[model samples]
Target: MGKLGLVKARHLVSRTGMGAEWATIQRYKNLTMNDAVAHTLSYVDYTLPRPPRTSSWTKTVGNRKSVSRQRNMMRMSKNEGAALQTWWANHMLTTKTPFLERMTLFWSNHFPSTIAGTKQPSALYHQNVMLRKNALGNYGNMLMAVSKDPAMLIYLDGYSNIKDDPNENFAREVLELFTMGGTVYYSENDIKNAARAFTGWSIDDRTGKFINRPEQHDTGVKTFMGKRGNFNGDDILKILLQHPRTAETIAEKMWKEFINTSRPNPGYTRKWAHIFRTSNYDIKTLLTAVLTSDVFWHPANMGGLIKSPVELAIGTMRTLPYRLRKNNLAHNLSLMGQSLFAQPSVKGWDGGESWISTQSLMRRSGLMTNLTRGNLRGKHDPLFMRHMPECSDEELMAWLIPVKPLHPLPTQPGRQRLVRALVLDPAYQVS
Candidate 1:
């Protein structure tokens, strides 16, 4: 078997563990690749920790945001977002189901929406629930769930859609960004039809629940993608899945993440697209196929992806033992440009090289410097056990990435300095 422990640490875990956690992977050294993959998926069945519900933030029974409530909502939502990020970091650091968490994060960006823009924390929390619930389960079910998600309804202006005036924001994005992937694959006519198909699709303002208003719905025929008949949001999704281009778009997206590169290998992507279509969008089936595929382990695609802020931070927390307060951890990440649910736009953060700019890199290093020193606690804060001077530079890199290295780390230091350097290195910045 290939290095099951190494592959698990690199692709699945947010940050590979050290000490006892590391030992557990080594203990499975003899596990076949198939067995190890099965082990990873089985972990997804484990129960995850739940954060406080955002719906409970208010005392009033109705969904109205009173003047005082609005003021509190503005202030408290920031902390709520931070706490959620902290919970995510803790799960990545400690859970056996890191692959599932990783998938949850992937879907979060793939269906990009932000709590800051929604102005309703409860909706955002539930949207996250929707993503996690179907992270590796089924893309079609996930699509249906997100199409009716409260946070998504607010973010995409689905609440504004009505029989009298169809709002095209959500429909346009669903086609351009979510399914077809670009304008070339669809036309403006398709967008209008899709929007009309979702008329009266809105959320309950008080409870942040999805509700279909029959009176507001246009129960007439919608010519979506040239197919004519009375159709609604669910029907549109089913129709969209029938298009071969939609399957190709999803496969290409997943391939980018799996292979760690922006460039598409058409031959390999088409293969996965076939699997996705034939499997009826079974997410776990496609992912399992990709992970077991030879392309995933190719040297050209390994260790080159730039780490998003969440990955950079969570990886650190996993490798080292630190009990950082969730709020502070969230604040630090915000400064680095990724604030959990507060994405800057509906398109989500531009990953890859976009994650690194001159300013952001400095900020990233600064964050690393703070974590290395004891900013997590007080001055001279105790975190690590001792120096790992005996660990070769090659070995250290192996802990963070899947590829064999071109060279060893030039700088050698005590355990603390090694960590600081690793965290700051351009190599460590990537997956």
Candidate 2:
């Protein structure tokens, strides 16, 4: 494990927690771990200024349909669409906690949902709020909220589930994707039984409320994992949580996300899983333990991972010597397959290797060029050079990059010359 001074620590935190920034990272460099952790957590709730609206539909049942119609109309209007883009731009620029914001962004992709598919932006928005506000909170709470989430209800066909005719989509995903690993922990019968338990649990299309229609609920006894019960959705969840695989599977995913590998050490991951379950699914503790470990700060681990497209774009922009307008910034990201509220599918954007291809590489290189050369409108900052006075050219390269130190400046005159010639290099492209 690397025990870094403040300067290096800032770089590590920013890359791992948020995408990238120089000033805030340097500012936090001198602080103790406690202070630094608190400062990092503070940047989470940079909510955009919501426009005011006097909707009479929220007051009574009669106006509800009109309200929904109005919402749909606004969604279709070009002006409102432009404003939405503007809101995201401003939020990204001015948010207090870039670390938390980026973490929320990371989780959003990890558990992908699309307002375009669900036609429920409010539910998508609700899920965003839930994830952002509680990204580091209890995993159990997040799981439960996601289970009944309005966006999730529609995305996974939870709303279509009926008492006698249960939809297995949500239940299967909850087990196979969300909590447990593959079929190792659950059999086909368990999935079928779990599906029955979730019947009658749905969202109200008009109000976005989670409604449990007991009348439509399946009350049949279920034999799940060799145990019998008149299991409902909650019962299914409870049973899943109780399984050892649930804890281990989640620990594995968490390690992959933060530790930068899908194939993390299972023994070590299981140890962390025990820590997570023992602490009652406190995600923060799990994250802290992982981040502060020797495995995390090792030279081999540094920059060994690929940056997701969103990370590449955002990090490059933030590190640029310019000021990008919010609308344009958000627009640029949208074109690069990472629009804020619009993911492609329920599986979300595949990270790591899948995030790159011939088409995506062009988009990535183009974004870097646009940001660096002041090609973007109203976004040219000359102050970027001053952000890292302490970091020399070689140190700057190391600071911005999460990779092992390349040949130091004095050793490789030709490579140093090349680095000076190119504003963006292959190193910056790595994590």
Candidate 3:
């Protein structure tokens, strides 16, 4: 791969790290594949923003240590959550490497839940944290963690389930969406049976603590995946994780997220599947194999995928020499159908072609104009710098929108005209 190829690779992985800046890419310019893999993994905890303040319901519990009360605290107002979002945008743009942030964003979509409904900003933020923590670890462990996540619990109505009448939402989604992708690894009978297993799974109203009420649970044995047993939600997850289809489903997602190519390379997927299962689902090992694969850096794949709203928003922010605020940044992302911690449904956003449409393209174009013209105020206000204190105009343009200039900009011109022409160009519409 040449310099451009390196830039492409860095951008692709930014889905795992958001989009690493040019300076960060330059640091690893000469690293061998193995060395680069190690270097990247070392960036899991590269840098982070301060924790955001959470919401608290008026019905306050004096005991701050209680999960219910804590959950309430996490569900702060939109204004409060804005601070945290700002922190995130700043960190991602400025971090030496944002691989974990990008990876967390990917998993958030994959496992898709919305904190908006639950009003639990803290739990939502915590779920994001958990995703980052395990984004590149063990799939089984991560799945289990997501299953119990407070944000997920509330988002999927797991908190409303009881022994007498199981909600069935979480149980159905766990098999159909989270692990198996609705391929009949499980059946309706299995869903009913699984719901019984998860009876009494509820959360504290004020505090967001998950509780298992034995009285609400059905202890009767039932069959799942052709196996007969009294299975609970955890048992269902375990069965799915142990199934071959489970491995296949997860491997396919890895292929799309890291590869982002049109069709899946089954040969590549299978090679990684064997490694994933053999290594007990180690994420790092699987990613290492994929990233080091020859096809990942191929020229044919460059700019082949459309940038998700999140990617377009963050990539622009990182490349441009500017800043943004939390609310404005969140607002732009929301307009793009990818607000952090707020997905449309349990299935999450269907990536790839789903992000492209006439309306979406228009919104992206509008955002570009606003960003470059200093008209937009996101998490980091002034997300662009027309007057670089040090670098020349050409260098600033190259730094900010390196993918493909929206237009051929003059070295010096009215910032308004230059930004408008470049942002309106088709290249800015694609990655």
Candidate 4:
């Protein structure tokens, strides 16, 4: 009920948004907890810069049909995909509503479609837009839209699905990964039937839009989850939405995303799932419940999550006056293991402890070191230092690091020196 002071404000911003930005934390520190949460959910910026030019689906398809041009097509796709990654990274670095972009990134992993898998950056660009449009709106709606998304259709082999020879890739992942969390709730037969139901959902070759070919559709009765009916792709999605586990799956993911990387408590997840399902899968409603829950604000949970590459790199840049020496942030992120458009697998990046492997830890530490190298020297830029918040040493430590510095602070008294020490400390690795 009281105002969320500096510590609490940082937790909310770092967990929900891209980073615990200084100005944002200062703004939130004065507001009541409820007001702060409301403000975070409400603020969103929809404007996007012009996307990088990529080959149209029609052109790409034409090229793919020719054996000699196939290699050229692959090269083109790789080049365009890298540009797409950079474009998105730039947006995340500068977005006014980092929370909106953060949620968009979350959903992207939940329903992944890779540049390599699709070979269509244009379609992936559209898919990213669709994800952001519904990021905070409705889970059920997003599910329906993404299921037919052209990038997903190609990535999951859904576009190749026809009545005569049904491709089960999309159905299998939808049941196992997207909705149910695993094979525990649905049967193999359910997946086969669900695949049959989704048969005719394909992409328009000329326009690259979702197009249902009724002639290719299987109009037979299918039993999905013990319910028998003549079904289509929409029907299958509607049935999944009605399943309780669909809501629970998202709730559990939110736990890992916002709380900590440990296994989620079912008691908490089930309660959140009920709220999600009852609200007709309203995303904001579920987010409000999760953000306001006791566990989200618990003292023991502070610094519980390991920072993803985006959080470490983009978050640091946003919070401080530092920038990467090289502008190839997208490539840097790939090296650090969170490439924007190219997830390693359908499971996406296994964040958490996985983000800090021996190789990745070195990269992470090296990044922080490089960003703070200039500041570490006594030759601090007076203009930049003056622009920084005027605060005591203790306050500065709290603002920069989520927890007490794992290593001792510097004996030297310069503000820049202290900041460099806090950032380089092991404790700065977590939120």
Best by TM-score: 4
Tell how far residue 378 is off in model 4, in angstroms. Answer: 4.0
TM-score computed on alpha carbons, candidate 1: 0.86
Question: How do all models score by TM-score?
Answer: 0.86, 0.83, 0.82, 0.98
Per-residue lDDT over 1-431 for candidate 4, one digit per residue giving the tens place of the 0 to 100 score = 78899999989999988877888999999998889999999999999988999999999899878999989889999999999999999999999999999999999999999989988999999999999999999988899999999999999999999999999999999998899989879999999999999999999988999999999999999999979999998999899999999999999999999999899999899999999999999999999999999999997888999999999999988988889755578888998999888899998888889998999999999989988886755535685586578888878878877788879888977778888898899999999
Candidate 4, poorest ten consecutive residues by summed lDDT: 375-384
lDDT of 4: 0.91
- Model 2, stretches more than 4 Å misplaced? 1-3, 31-46, 51-86, 374-391, 404-423
Model 3 lDDT tens row, 57-122 = 323334245776665445444555566566565565656556777777778888876656656566
Write down the RMSD of candidate 1 (Cα, Å).
Answer: 4.1
Task: Rank candidates, TM-score, best first.
Answer: 4, 1, 2, 3
lDDT values, one for every candidate: 0.71, 0.66, 0.67, 0.91
Residue-wise lDDT of candidate 2 within 316-391, one digit each (tens)?
Answer: 5565444555457767777676777666765566566666678877877677666666322221322443433445
Model 2 lowest lDDT segment of ten: 52-61
Number of clashes found in candidate 4: 0
lDDT value, candidate 2, whole model: 0.66
* Models sorted by lDDT, best on top: 4, 1, 3, 2
lDDT for each residue of candidate 1 in 280-354, tens digit (9 for 90 to 100): 999877877777787775656566567777777765665555445555766667778877787778777767778
